[model samples]
Target: MSRISVLVVDDSATMRSLIAATLRRDTDIEVVGFANDPLEARDAIKRLNPDVVTLDVEMPNMDGLTFLEKIMRLRPTPVVMVSTLTQAGAEVTLAALEIGAVDCVGKPGAGVTAAEAFGDLAMKVKAAARARVRPLGSAPVVEKREGYSGGDKIVAIGSSTGGVEALLTVISAFPENCPPTVITQHMPATFTKSFAQRLDRASAAHVTEAVEGAPLETGRVYLAPGGHTHLEITSGAHPRCRLVPADPVNGHRPSVDVMFNSAAKHGPRVVAALLTGMGRDGAQGLLALKEKGARTIGQDEASCVVYGMPRAAFELGAVEKQLPLGRIGPAILDLCSAAAPGRDQ
Candidate 1:
């Protein structure tokens, strides 16, 4: 097979060189070109036609966001954002994801080293290379869920890889009074806080990073904090968010399986969905939910950037329904209506 070609775009010479070296460590990836600014990137993109582009979120002459817009508009391709590990940089990086960049890794900054910077870059670039690119204007419109009833059910969603884009579409469609939702997305500490904030801004429902003992409430969403803790549900008058410190499960802290397995103890009151991700982290836990008569859904392969997780769940007979990415939000809403508090028939 041919090598996975990459174009490294960053204003800092050191950053570009460092990124190139990191990607080169993987035998399958080759550095096709380097661009110091968007203008150079524009020219190099046409010349090199690389499989992936590692783009700096900030640069002189046409910022990365505007340049990313043009890339999505004129030429849709897999792009990964290399953003600074700052609040402003986090905002820009989240916008990049919304604009169709496959994924992002924080640039080396205070509290982040070059070694930590490359932690996910090469793997993300490889995944992005095989990712499907959709034109900027051709995305599915998010239709907010209407006529929602009060639901007693708890919703747990697990995703990675194509998740930032997929979750934007799904969560934004939820009503302001949607069921209590818990999400466990594979992300590093630098990204999750910004991601949760982005979700809060985008969705009508209240969204927050999970705290140690936050009470689960309807109309609110809790995103698991990235790093060392897993999000779990504790039984009570109403389910509450239980953040527990633990080793990585299925190679991820705050793993979907831990959340789902804990929710499984609640029996039929939980509704679980496994979104697009790189591996089989959530499959078994989703099956556990299904076994307890909870409604389980999986994103279909065609709509997934990496079909690994959802495919694993489907093969395991964990998913009661397999729907395209565009349909999952409405499907979840339907499930909520069926099981709403006092409305369950």
Candidate 2:
């Protein structure tokens, strides 16, 4: 079989060498070239035509975001961002994903082992190589106008890997009257608090870490605390977050399936979305939601960081509409407002 070719782009020679070395360890991946900046990367792209590109967020000539925007506009290919593990870095990484990068990996500084910095980089690169590329013009941008006027409703979403950015994009698009949104994005316990806080700042909805017994309210968003499986509503009259200590489901602690299943039981006929992520975490639960008559949408393969979960759901006939990442939020609003019996909005 042909190996997956890669291009490493970073202003720092050390980082570029480190990333290239780590990726080359994987027999299936071949580091075809390296570039010091976006301008240099452009020439490499025309010459080598690599299957994927590992880009640094901060660069000299042009920042990764600007390069990503240009790449999406001129020639959309799979790109994975390498960023530091700071709050500022997290915010920029999220923006990069929204702009067009397939996924992101945190960079480890000196004294950190390659094993540490490249924790999941190889896997992400492999996934990106297989991903479908779409032009930036075809990608969805957040809308400034109100798209829905609906009564109290709930929106349950779940994702992993590239979800940090995907969730932000979807939630930020929501208006003040947007339905109560609950999310279970796969992340470490140490990061969930910061992630929620960051999302709260960027999004209109009141975002907070899910606490046991907290009432589910419209216009507020809840994130399932990491390190535990957060199940959906237990009762119809009052739906609250349920966190449980259990073995990881579908290889994720805060599994999407667990949340979706809970949502299907508690918020029957509500709107649900399964965004980009690895593995089949959300597929079965989404199928259950579909069976319960909830409007379900899956991120199209072309827009996913890793298409595993969404593809599984799509193959199982669970998704009602397969949409690009940009259209997901609007589609949810439309579904909530449409006249349907048993649906709150």
Candidate 3:
């Protein structure tokens, strides 16, 4: 296979050099060029046409988000954002994913060693190179459906790259009486709490980080805590969340597959959604869910940030419906309602 060429974009000379050096260490990745700002990056993109770009969230003159918007609108390519691991940075990085970034890696702190950060940077770059790209004009939107029965129905959602925004969009459309929802979104330990809090503030549903023995209740949303795998519905009468310390699955500690697999075993008749992400993590688990009689949905390629996970599941016959991001929420409601006995036909 040809080497995966990359363009590094950052304002800091030290950061640029560090990123380039780290990428160079990987035989499969080649640093084709470096740009200190979006203007320079644009010129480099036109000239070098690297397979991927590692972009900084902040830069002089033009912000990375603005530049990223243009990149998606004009020449869509795989982009991996390098952002600080702060609340503000997390918010912006989430936005970048919604705008079409394949993935993101937080830059190490000031006191941290370069070797550690470089290792992570190299991995993200390689992942970005393999990510599937989509046109910005044709991205998926989350659609809202009315007239959902508020009973014992359950909803399980999994996502990675662009999950924060995509999840917010889908869940926000849910009414206060929407079904009990459990979510596993790829995020760091420090960020999951804040993310759940943010979601709760934005939506009508009560959102909280999942805890062991916590009952899955209606009108509530549970998010897998960071740094731990969250298994679903261990007990039937009062479905509770289980947290376990395990090795990362598909390179994520709180993997979507782990959650979805558990859901398949415990809540086979529930509704499952596989959203935008960068790898084939949830594919097998979604297949398990489908085999066990769960209604499964995958975010369509056009609306995905990377289209890796969903595409993998869809190809494996794991997904029952491939819908745009906008139509997913309503579709879930429709599926659940159809399964109900006395609901409006």
Global lDDT scores for all candidate models = 0.88, 0.81, 0.81
Order the candidates by lDDT, highest first — what do you get? 1, 3, 2
What stretches of model 3 exceed 4 Å from their correct place? 110-115, 118-120, 130-139, 229-231, 338-345
Candidate scoring better on TM-score of 1 and 2: 1
Clashes in model 1: which pairs? none
Model 1, C-alpha of 189: deviation from truth (Å): 2.0
Q: Report the C-alpha lDDT of model 2 over 6-76, residue by residue, as the tens digit.
A: 99999988888888888888999999999999999999999999999999999888888999999988888
- Write the residue-wise lDDT of candidate 1 on 177-243 in tens digits: 8889999999877688989988998888999999988988989999999878999989766778898
Q: Residue 214 error for model 2, in Å?
A: 2.9
Error of 2 at 232 (Å): 5.0
lDDT of the structure predicted as candidate 1:
0.88
- TM for every model, in the order presented, reads 0.94, 0.81, 0.86
Prediction 2 TM-score vs. true: 0.81
Better of 1 and 2 by lDDT: 1
Off by over 4 Å in 1: 143-145, 338-345
The candidate that achieves the highest TM-score relative to the unseen native structure: 1
